[model samples]
Target: MLLEDMLNHQTKIPTEWHTSIRKVGQKFDSAAEVRLALQYYSIAKRFEYDFYHNEQRHIRVYCRFKHTHGCPWMLFASPLRNLSIMSIKNFESTHTCGQHGENAGNLRASRKFIASQIQAVLKVRSDLRAVDIKNDMLSNFSIKINYSKAYESMVHATNTGSRVVIDADDRRFRRLFISYNAYIEGFIARCRPLLFLDGTFIKDRYRGILLSATGENPYQPPHRLIVISDADKGIRATIEEFFPDAFHSRCVLHLVENFKKNMKDFGHKTNVATTLDELLQSAAYKFTISE
Candidate 1:
């Protein structure tokens, strides 16, 4: 009734297929060859493949149906020394049992392949929810993935999409930021030479100061914002280290706050503090440097 049934009875086997065991000694330059071989074998035998040993240089796959009791239908392959091409080293064709069923060796859930597909989806829609992702996978690929696996895939995809660099420790986190090629390119092309630096406190589980640098784009109305963490030295040191030649300016709001705090510490009365704040604001809005 099935291909495996026909093959087990010594019925005629197709010799035209490229994936026949007769093609074993053939050379391959990528892991795709091994996958193709496994797919072809699974289709012929109606059994799934479970990898026992999968690595960069070597691979060992066994029949999932008989893998627990040690089925002899195994496939082994490795790359050639001093060459990139991979060749099959050994293969066992005899199975101790009949075919399992259709959809036996589906590889849509493989870690590497799934991670890559998730990354592609995240690149376009970074806000996609994990539950939605799981639903989409089921609807599109007929692959039912658990919530944890989908969440892990989403996190992996997000990290891959946004290249976040960090310096931290168990006690405290020092610095963290996202830097991508497109952001860098847009900043260089559209933003002005002047940079405004500022920092604010984040009210989160792990409270930390969020330092940001903003620049005005000549062709665009929106400011290009880049978030870079301040090392122990301070925001000035961090900005200077990265943008040594750029013209830096302090935020007027921070300047006013510091001035007000200093005035208050000097025992200034309410009237005096209010007057000083107005004077500071007026000075900040002056049109000429001499004013």
Candidate 2:
């Protein structure tokens, strides 16, 4: 009755699909091709390279492809192979230090460490809302880092401070920064986001632009995305103006807590909070407008 059931009925592989898979195998690295072949009996829809292990490996993955049959079949296909002709070796060796040239390996490791440190700090700061990373935190990390240099590097990378002027008018540097910023913005845009707009009073009694976007999860604090703001408006209005197509939801928990504190009668407040909680918790509330 199920698609898998139907697929299981045929023990032999379809000639067309087998031919297609063989063609797909040629596009990947030999290592990945081997993994693909290993999943011959088990249908593969996708694959990923595993790098954290001592030896580089390619993981054969599966996915459910739904169709009009009212049943889903595991598609043993590779989008990476069809769309891009990246050698399986490239995928497997990208994470290894020695696979690239010796100089490249050193640079790669340094850059990787710097990037990892920045991400770690960002994550911690986001969680605490303000992280005062002192000697204790530094010691715990087990790395001999000059915090000042590390901070400076991060600030430069984040574009919050002056960039190292290798060449002031270099088109290549401009292009690289532009591309990097675009990539970071794209990453943030795809995730659950929170946009906040405010003004920070500066010298000479003038206020500066203070627009920031962040990705928030109830399970964790959010990554900050700072951008210059142009106006004073309600958070909702600013969010709507900037990202009209984006999804937004008010913090109902905060709202309920505020309501409880304002109301004098505990019993009545509790009832109201319970009702509000039920209404918001319902799956229907998100898709429908509250009357």
Q: Please give, for residues 22-106, the per-residue lDDT of candidate 1 as tens digits.
A: 4455567777766655554554444667787578668788777675656678778888888878788888877775655444434
Model 2 regions more than 4 Å off? 1-150, 154-213, 216-249, 262-272, 280-286, 289-291
Per-residue CA lDDT of model 2 for 1-291, tens digit only, reads 243344334333333322333333345444545443433322211112222232333333222112222222222323354453323222211121112111211211222244434556665564322123323223433223333434444554454323332222433322112223543554455643444333445456443343334433332226443322333347558667876665545444444455555453555666776675566556334665654
lDDT of 1: 0.62
Q: How many clashing residue pairs appear in each of the predictions shown?
A: 0, 2
Give the candidate number with the greatest lDDT.
Answer: 1
Candidate 2: 10-residue stretch with minimal lDDT: 93-102
TM-score of predicted model 2?
Answer: 0.24
What C-alpha lDDT do the candidate models reach, one value each?
Answer: 0.62, 0.37
User: Model 1 segments beyond 4 Å from truth?
Assistant: 1-116, 119-127, 130-161, 166-176, 179-182, 204-206, 219-233
lDDT, model 2, position 112: 29
